[model samples]
Target: MNPLVITVNVKSTVYCDFQLRWYPWDDPHCFLNLKVTNVPSFGLLVDGTSTVTMRPELLEEYEVVECRLQETPHPTNNLTLLVHLTRRYQYHLWTTFLPTSLLAAIGYGTLLLPLEAFAERGSMSLTTLLMFIALYTETNSSLPSTAYLKHIDVWFVFSLIFLTLVINVHLMTFLADSESAGQSVRPTPSRHLTHVSAPPFAKRVRDRMAVPKRILRMSTVLFALVFIIFTLVYFLAIV
Candidate 1:
């Protein structure tokens, strides 16, 4: 019977002399068993074509291992291959994922504010959204200029736009409610009601129309329209 022997090799910048053997009968699925004696780094580069140095003694220990042919070349060579395993990839994790998630949380702040406070609280949403935009810009500045959008950038921009629209819509709703109430009652009647005893229903109506509804409604509508048009133009410009 011919003795089953397998050769193993290590290819690296730092000396990584290793040997591998296959034990086909031990594990049916994975017959290859890799072992190294003198190498410092256990990580091996498995690029398709290379003469890898192997210690003969380690191969002799495991006699029945099956060796599989190389499928594809390693995507990158030398130290470039090692970069994939390093902590550098963590930048992608923190920059893109963390800020986008934080922005989404900040967006919920708008919902917490009373709808009546939309006039004053509207700035909070816009400010938070702008803060995210600034963060997105800063994060992007650090990244390499690539044609395709990064995952985090996409999420941040989407959240920014979404929150902007949400704030605008709330403002518009408040303005419309205010304006309708204002138009329903005349200013002359409102002035006279202050002197005479106003009906309970009239008092409620006056309270509701305390805000300058007509001007605000027109302003809100115009703001939304301009914002929408600008957003569309900006998106087109970016694309």
Candidate 2:
């Protein structure tokens, strides 16, 4: 019979497995067994970094063993060799997480801009979103496909959602400002000039925006708090 061979895939860069097995034909009085005397690093690039553990032995059923014994006129049994491994993806923090965090910061900066600078804020938000999309696409392309999401996946998804909400805030603020500006446009009424005459146009506009501006500021704070809480919970859960 041919020797047993096992191959593993390291595409995930998260974990790997190795299996080794052999069969022995002997009398019932004699036994065949395997043991782990020493485990080398397996020639991995990141040797000693990955966590490795073995599974309990799994023996073949009695029926199968008996059949093999009778058919071959010898004693034989089957066994399994299994191992589990885990690895941390520290590299992604710089390559993926850092850039994503910066993108999120850029999105938040747009909120501080004045509502009158609609074009500037809108462009900033859109640009941040586009750059985030490109970064996400590039990162995912190199990862192996899996049914379940990875830790980095969660990070990217949350970042995208945050950016989308920022963009929405910009849109809503612009609309509110535009509506207020339109309503404020009225013919000046002739009246005796006084020290307390109607405030300058800029001050009047600013006064009208007090509520919306407060609401926008509160929304920014709320977004930040939510993001911080989410990140804490997510990291704790993952760890």
Q: How does each model score on TM-score?
A: 0.45, 0.61
Q: Pairs clashing in candidate 1? A: 22-64, 22-65, 23-65
Question: RMSD (Cα, Å) of candidate 2?
Answer: 14.5
lDDT of each residue in 201-226, candidate 2, tens digit only? 88878876876687679878998898
Question: How many collisions per candidate?
Answer: 3, 0
The candidate maximizing lDDT is: 2
Q: Residue 98 of candidate 1: its Cα lDDT? A: 67
Predicted structure 1, TM vs. truth: 0.45
Local distance difference test scores for all models: 0.51, 0.63
The per-residue C-alpha lDDT of model 2 at residue 134 equals 98
- Could you give me the TM-score of model 2 versus the true structure? 0.61
Candidate 1 lDDT trough over 10 residues, lowest sum: 78-87
Q: Which stretches of candidate 2 lie above 4 Å from their native place? A: 1-77, 186-200
